[model samples]
Target: MGARLLFVAALTLGVSGLAAAGAAATGAERCAVDDLERRVCLEAPARRLVALSPGATELAFAAGAGERVVAVVAHSDYPARARKLPSVGDYNRIDLEALVGLRPDLVIGWVTGNPEEQLETLESLGTQVFYIEPRTVEGVAGTLKRIGRLAGSEATAEQEAEAFLDGMEKLEARYAERDPVRTFYQVWDAPLMTLNGEHLIGRAIEACGGANVFGDQPRLVPRLDDEAVLEANPEVIITGSDEESMDNDWLGHWRQYPNMAAVAEDNLYTVPADPLVRPTPRFLQGAQSLCERIDQARPGSGAE
Candidate 1:
C-alpha cells in the first residue's frame, strides 16, 4: 500500500503539472495527438461532433463535450443523453450520407473498433477525426485530457481525469500488495474465451493482486476448451454480466467441474460488463468491485 501510494502520488503530480503547462501553451487553434500519433488540429471548439464508437461517445461526454456531440453510433448509450443522439450507424457500418448531413465539425473514433475504410473516407471528406485507443489504465486518463483539449473543455476534462486517477489509486492501495491468487477471467462462454495480459480485463486482474492464468496468451482474446481450463485450475474464476440485473450463468457452468479449484471453493464472481469492458471513467468503479471480490477470496478472508 505504501509503495503504491507513493507511485500514485508521483503520477498524479506529474500529470497535473504537465497539464497546466500544456494548457498555458494553447493558442487560437486546439490540437491533440491521437493514438496513431497523428496531430489533429481544429481552428475552434467543435460545435457539432460525431462519435463513431460507444467508448468514444462516453469519453466525449466525460470531457464535457456532450452538448457538442451531434451524432453517435448504435450502442453509444451512456450518460443517458447519448442514446437520444442521432445515429449514423453502428461501429461496423456507417451511413455516409446521414453522417454528412449532420455537418459534424469533428468526429471522434476508435482506432481498433471502427472500420478503417470509413474513417479514411471521412478524413478525405475534410472531417477532422481524433482517434483514441486506451491500452493502459493511465492511457485512459490521458485520453480524457486529449479529448478535452480537442473539444476546448480542458478544465472539466482535467477534473474528471484527476478524479479517475485518484479512484484508481484508492483501489491500488487497497489491493496491490494482497496475497496473490491465481485467477481466470472468462470473457465469453460459447467457445470459452479469456483475455491476455495486453487486454484491460487482464490488467484489472493484475491490479487486484491476482495473476491471470492465461495472461501470456499471444492473442488479445483467446479461445479455450474445458480441458485447458481444468489444466490451469485457477483459484478464482470471474466473468462479467451484460447488465447489473442479469445473472451470470457462465460462472455457474463451471460448477459441473467439481474438482476445479475455483469451483470447489465457490470463488466464482461477476461484475457489470459495460463498466469493466468499456475504457471509460466508469472503469474505476468496476475495478474496485473486482478487487473487493478477490480480497474476499484470499486465504484469511473466511470464504466458503
Candidate 2:
C-alpha cells in the first residue's frame, strides 16, 4: 500500500499530471488536468456523458452521478433511468455517428475489451474516454473512486466504495473456514468456453472458496469440449443461460447434458445477464449469486 501511494504521488507531481492521470482515490480530487491529459484525461463532475458498458453505467449510478450520463450502450439495462438514456449501440459494433450526435463531454468504456480501432476513431473525433476494468472486488472500489472523482462526486464514491468493501470482507470471511470447491463456470457450452483466470469473474470464483475447473487455462475466455470438462469432473457447475434467451432449443440442448454434475443437480441459473456479464460493482452480486447456486449443487457448502 505504501508503494502504491508513492507511485501515485510521483504520477501526480503537478496540476498537469492531475489532469492527465486518474487521481489517487483517497481524498478531495482535483479533476484538473494538463492539456495533453486534458485531451485524454477524464475529470468528473461530468455533466454530459456516455457509458458503453453495463458495469460502467451502474458504477456511475452507484456513485450518484447517474444524472450526468447522456448516452449509454444499447445493452446497458439497469436502474431504469439507464434505459431512458439514448443508446449509442453495442460496444464491439458502436455507431460512432450516433454517439457523436449525443454530444457528450466524456465517454466511458473498458480500456482493453472494446475495439481499439473504434476507440482510435473516437479519439480521432476528439472524444475523451475513460477505460477502467476492475480485477478484484477492491478494484471495483478503486474504479468507483476514480469515476467519482472524475465525475466530481468524491463523497458519494467513497460511501459506495466503502459499502462494497464491507460486503466483500464479509464474503471473504465466509469462505475463510473452508477449502475451495472444484467448480466449473460455463459462459457458453457450444464451444465450451470459460473465463481465463486473469479475468475478474474467475478471481471472484477463487475468492468465493470455489476453484475454477479451468483455473490452469490461460485465456480471458478459453474454449473446451465435453471431454475436457469431464476430465475436470468438477464438484459443482455454475452457469447462466445463453444468447438465445431461455428459448426451447437452448434448454433442450442443455437438457442433453443432465448426466453432468451441474445438470444432475439442476444448478443452472439466470443472472442479470447484463451487469453480471461485466466486471463492475454488480460482480459481487454475481459472485454471491453463483456461490448460492454452487452451495445448492453440493449440500453444506455455503450459507442458505
Candidate 3:
C-alpha cells in the first residue's frame, strides 16, 4: 500500500510540473519582453483571431495560422486568401460589436498606427490585443519569429526568415553598383500625398533599387505641392490603387501628364495597397515584385 501511494504521488508531481511549464510558455511574451514592440508580438498564437492590421494579418497567414483567424481588417487582399476572411473593420476603425461577437482569443493591431478609440473598445472586452511596431525589413524578421513562437510554429517562422534573407541577398547583388533610380511614390493625388523614408512603404522603394525623392521627409505621409513634385523630378513615378477609393484609375490621370518623363516613358506603376502596404512575410514578395518591375523599367540592370 505504501509503495503504491508513493508511486501515485510521484506521478502527480511530474504532471503538475509539466502543466506549470506549459502555462509559463502560453503566457504572452509581452509582459516579460523588455522591448514594447517585441513584447506585443510575443502575445500571439491567437486562435479565433481578429486582425486589425494588414501586416499582422499577413504574418498570421504566413505562420500557417490562418485557420485560427476569424476575421481581418478591410483591404487585407493579399495572398488571395485574405480576401476570403470575414471583416472586422478598416485600418483606423472597427465595429466593436462585431469584433466582440467573434469571441476572438486574440486581437492584433498596430501601436500608435491605429486610432485610440477603436483600440479602447476592443480592450474593454478583455481580449488580448497585440501591437506590432515593425519599422524595417530586419524588424519584420523579429515579428515573424515572435509571432511564430506564440503560434507554436517556430520552425516555420525560422524557415521564412531564411527564405526572406536569401531573396534579399539576390536582390542586393542584382542591383549592386547599378544606377539608383530617383522615384516618386504617390499615395494620393488631390493633396499629392507621398511617402517618407521612415515608413515601410518608402523603405520598399529603396529596396527596389530606387531612391525616394522625398527621402528627407520624416512623416509617413507628406503633402507635396505640384512644384515640389516637379522639383523632385523622379525618373519613375510609382502610384498604386485609386486615391478616390475607386478601382485603380491612376492610368486615367497619368495620361494627362504626357509631358512628364515617367508618363512619356510609361514608368507609371500601380501596386495594390492591400498586400503591398502590409508588413508581413508576403511584403517581401511584393517588394520583390517591385524590384522586378524596376529592373524591367531600367532595362540594363541585372535581373536576378
Top lDDT prediction, candidate number: 1
Candidate 2 global lDDT = 0.69
Whole-model lDDT, model 1: 0.84
Candidate 1 per-residue lDDT over residues 1-304, each given as its tens digit: 2454345434544543454455556645688899999998876666778998899999999999998999999998898999999899999898776776666768888898889998887676566789888978899999999989988899999999999999888787878678998899898899899999899878888988988999999999999999999999999898888774758778878999999999888899887888888899999988877787777678786432
Give the lDDT of residue 3 in candidate 1. Answer: 55
- Against the reference, the lDDT scores of all candidates come to 0.84, 0.69, 0.69
Residues 167-190 of candidate 3 have per-residue lDDT tens digits of 766766767666788788778888
Candidate 3: deviation at residue 271, Å?
Answer: 3.7
Clashing pairs in 1: none
TM-score of 2: 0.78
- For lDDT, candidate 1 versus 2, the one ahead is 1
Task: Give the top-scoring candidate (TM-score).
Answer: 1
